[model samples]
Target chain A: MTEERDPHLARLFAEAPEPQADEAFVDAVRMGMARGRRMDLAGALAMSAAVGLTCVALAGPVAQAVGQVAGQVAPVMAELFDVPGGEILAVAFAGLMAVSAMVLSRVRV
Target chain B: MRPADSLRLSNAPEAQVIALAAAGSDEAFAELVRRRQGSLRALMRRLCGDAALADDLAQQAFLQAWRTLRQLRSPGAFGGWLRQVAVHVWLRHARLVRPPLDPIEDLDAEPAAESPDPAARLDLSAALAQLKPTQRLCIILNYVEGLSHAEVAASTGWPLGAVKSHIARGTARLRRLLSVEVLS
Candidate 1:
């Protein structure tokens, strides 16, 4: 047990290689976690949509009001979405905004 | 890095970073990865005895840490937690890849480190090679990283007395094997 303090062995242990993880690997793990969160949010949104559709089928007047609002907004939204890739860009922007909101809520400010 | 921007909580205390990481904070996880990578690499090198394998194992360990972070019992105990994860990663890989045994005979015949380059640290590595996989891991964790016998036991899931015995026996064998080169 006393010989356990042998400097040679200790030095060897100290000298053993210690490599650092690169930024790329760290980025990959972060991306994986973010992707998982995005998928979860997507699933929740889809489930919500399905439930909303079921409710709309059961409630005629409420569904009619929803349709009226969509009818009014659809033309403008359609124009905004008409450009090539515009719909995708808009969806991405909305997702980014939601993520930003979540992040901001967690902040001290 | 700004407080808002730095994201990596590595600069914070291990407990703080661990808690943040456990709660699903990417910055905290990144910080944990950055802070522990060096120690993990050193431990893996001793256990696997190959630089490349050590690198791969260290990478895999970080990935596992991400998946298992929430299961960690105490945020304050993250260092030991990471070490434990690394041991598991090494053992898991050991199942698939049979690491080369230590060349004890070659080591015994080699002279002391009079070489100019520190690359001769391979002598220490070769001595570690002589140890059985578990024994080598215990030695590295106990002697090299300076973990307590209980910490080693807890991390490796070995009994307390068994941990002591492994350390004592492994240290004695390594000392005898490297006595010539290490001592002279």
Candidate 2:
């Protein structure tokens, strides 16, 4: 069936002009792809903030429990870790987890 | 020239490039674009009827191919697979943006060159413009691009019967156009 068609048409169309693309267009696509790869810092920061706030919210009861524990060993903790204080330590741990979660969220895979 | 030697489907450099691109290798993806850009652009232009639109579609197609390369089972089928991506990308883009009506009938019909020399093949591009998008693609994939019917079916995602029908119809239209040009 195909043989019945003009063999020359295939040849002619086959001879089509080489498809040329503008260099800048190619560059733009490359740039778009590059931008797609980079992390959106603002988005990441916002997510981090949300995670941190959530952690802090969830840490309320945990913090009360820690406070109860600390009341019993306040003097001991003071001697062992006399820095930012236990409440601060607890908050810091929660903050760290939130930050980790936020960073993890930014990853594509 | 001769459709750039009818590139074989291979897991070679082409497939590796697609794989690497899928793995987020920008350079590898760029290499794939650079290698296939000519043919892809040509096909897009033939199918879409505009060089600028073709370029845009080609870029999108390459990006899409890069994003989904991992889904492809055989790396050896990258070229055909990529063409399929291009076709979908073109169609999608066309859908999103209305196609400007082309008075295809108004275009002057030109005769196919008698010469088989490399320069003669240059006329193929003009002849392609006379065809409908589907017919042009069929001819390009089958003759200029040298993909088998099975490959064409696979690449276009059309049933084997549909592929055969399109090829037959497309070839007839092209032949008629060629004859018209010759007589004119």
Candidate 3:
């Protein structure tokens, strides 16, 4: 159904005196915003610290797992392709894993 | 910009103020709040039926608006955007702490005694309180906030048909309760 304008109701609202926001109210809101900003900063710092600690705690196990996977895979690759320096490939793969971990840690999402 | 310069921005047009605000000017945002807080608070008061709660909701709305000011694509539409934010804040709060049903009867039992003529304001407030939340919101947004039915639908994210129906039913109820006949 189409809506029709109700001027009487509109007039009642328009004519109703508005409640004023005193200086105290405005100051309170200003303070509230300042507090909110500080909280946001604190939250961001806390998140960053948490992510850093998590990465630090997991770094050892992650590195170990990456090294084991590379140790098992690099020789297979070397044998399949007749490539030398399986040890070098293993170290390179571990380094790549560390860099990826750091990158992911820095990402907010 | 210096602190004093930012205060001067309050005299600037809304679009200019919004632009400055988006650029991280707290004073510009404060100016916007100073200008718009009255109507926002009034709308909240009418919706929530508690002055203190309305003010709290208004502050929350302004804070939310400041955080997401950059998302506002049209600087000219700040008022409408702010109103939308206020409504969302109220809706969220309502969802968390749902009001008991039959608020109208409660208000009717003990009308506002402060007003010399309680019948006038009390009747309207009581009648409004009786409306279902969605119907009350639609009526307030359309009549009180001066939004068209389509604008009310867009703001509330309700279907256009639902908005129309709510307004129609709400208005009929209000008219009957107020004991006033439509002039035209």
Best by TM-score: 3
All models, DockQ values?
A: 0.27, 0.28, 0.41
Q: Among these predicted structures, which one has the highest lDDT? A: 3
TM-score per candidate: 0.60, 0.59, 0.74
User: Which numbered prediction scores highest in DockQ against the true structure?
Assistant: 3
Tens-place lDDT per residue, model 2, A50-95, is: 9999877766655555455446554654554556566677566556
Docking class of 3: acceptable
lDDT of 1 by residue, B47-76 (tens): 887887777778788878888888888776
List candidate 1 segments past 4 Å from native.
A1-7, A31-109, B1-4, B7-11, B98-122
Taking the candidates one at a time, how many backbone clashes does each contain?
Answer: 0, 6, 0
**CAPRI rating of model 1:** acceptable
Fnat of candidate 3 is 0.49
RMSD of 3: 7.0
Error of 3 at B98 (Å): 2.5
